[model samples]
Target: MISVVIPVHNEEKNIEPLFREIVAALEPLGEPFEVLFVNDGSTDGTAEVLRRLKERDSRVRVLTMDRNRGEAAALTAGFFHARGEIVASMDGDGQNDPAYLPEMIRRLREGGYAVVSGWRMKRKEPLLTRRLPSWIANRIIGLVTGLRVHDNGCSLKVYRAEVVKRVQIPHGFHRFIPAIFGVKNHEVAEVRILDRPRRFGRTHYGLKRTFEVLRELLTIRFVLGNRVFYEKALLAGGLISGLLAVISLLSSHRPFWAPGAFLGGSFLFFFVWHNLRRFNQAQKEGVFHVRELEI
Candidate 1:
């Protein structure tokens, strides 16, 4: 069984076509599948369309939140409700191709991939706003998290049901899901997917959202880089301690080596303090309480 999760926000016009395409693409696979439409408080006719679709097809399920809780929350709901052996997520803006499902499933099975991410090598978005920021973000993320995925913003990603069963996702951290699992020793693979120009509503993202994603990216990187940072801290502490021991043993006058020992202690203290500041900053912001969930 396979479960497809679609997160939609004000995408009324694209709902029907996306639903039909998913059905057409997945029906021929000769396996049981379910498509979950997570309506993230869309103000358009999206809710009505989903209700109708669910009434018509038993395989179509809708999880409507009381208000817009962003993509991460929506995806979390879908993941909890999904009951397939393989769980997948895609955007509801009609950009991600449903035709790629077969190949994605095949790769997940054959390659023993815990997560199969879809890479859109050729994008139809603008160069500066979308592509440029995305490119910079991908590179920085690759450098930081050591996950060299080309398209971290791509929504066409599939995960094994067992892998995502107890998974927890923070709001706005949806873009870095692969890296989150990747650094934890999960086997994540990528494959090229068709990126079609969206024919429905306009893009909901803006420069503000991009900046927010970048901030979150840095936080994720810092959290993942803790091991190396701590190792360096420990190495520095050990070397300074050993040097101080030797200096004290060989010193004719205590005053000469005392300053160097003080300096080493200061360096170690400053290094640990700086790293602590970063760790504190990486902590998640604010609090969240679920108002309602129909999952």
Candidate 2:
């Protein structure tokens, strides 16, 4: 069975049309499938629309959050409830075409890849506002994570159920799915897909989102890349600084630089210890708690 997970926020107008497109695209594959629409606390009638879709089709499942968490949280919820061995994810804005699902799945299987990401080579959005920011963000993400994909922000992607489910996607980290999977040594393949213009509401992304992506990118580099090496280096610096401070005091000619060095080293050691504790605690907690789930 193939499970398609879509995370939506205030996209009531596009839900029905997108659902029809999904059904049309998947019916030809002759396989069991399920559609999960995660309503991320939209104030509009998005929840009502999703409930209606669920009633109309048995294959449609709706997971409504109690409040607006974020896209990453919504995807995490959908993954927890999804029962398929293979899972596909796309945005609910209708910009992503459902027609590419078959080819993405086919490539995933044939190429022996854990993930098949959609690359929107020719985007239909404005070059200044949407395209330019995405282009710059993708480049920075590639440079930081070392998993260079053409489109890191593309929502249309397919992944093996086990591989994706094991990943810990924090709030606002949905854009880094390919990099997160790559850091764990998962083989990811990219397929060019059609990018359609929005048919309903305004885009949620903008220049502000670009800054947020940069902040999250730094966090990913620290946590997922060479965290242990950094921790050890800080530990050694802290110990050496302490030794110098003690020697300076015992020499009867205390150096003024020793105090500054000791303070800097103490801050570094505290920073590493504090982050290590927080990281361990985060591992034991879920990204988002379940408020309600409807099938």
Model 1 Cα lDDT, one tens digit per residue, 1-295: 8999998999999999998999898999999999998889889899888888888888888888778878877887788778999998999999998999888999989988888888996788988888888888888877777777878899998888877654356666677777765434358788898789898898987677786675565456544556457545655675666677577767787876675766677565455445434434323332122332332
> What's the TM for model 1?
0.76
Candidate 2 ranges with C-alpha deviation above 4 Å? 182-186, 226-281, 291-295
Give the distance in Å from residue 74's predicted Cα in candidate 1 to where it truly belongs. Answer: 0.8
Best by TM-score: 2
C-alpha lDDT score of every prediction, in listed order? 0.77, 0.81
Q: What is the C-alpha RMSD of each candidate to the true structure, in Å?
A: 7.7, 4.3
Poorest 10 consecutive residues of model 1 by lDDT?
A: 286-295
Candidate 1 regions with alpha-carbon error over 4 angstroms: 182-186, 225-295
> Each candidate's TM vs. the true structure?
0.76, 0.82
For candidate 2, lDDT tens digit of each residue in 187-284? 88888987999999878877788767765664566556565675566567667777776777677677777777776777656565445434434456
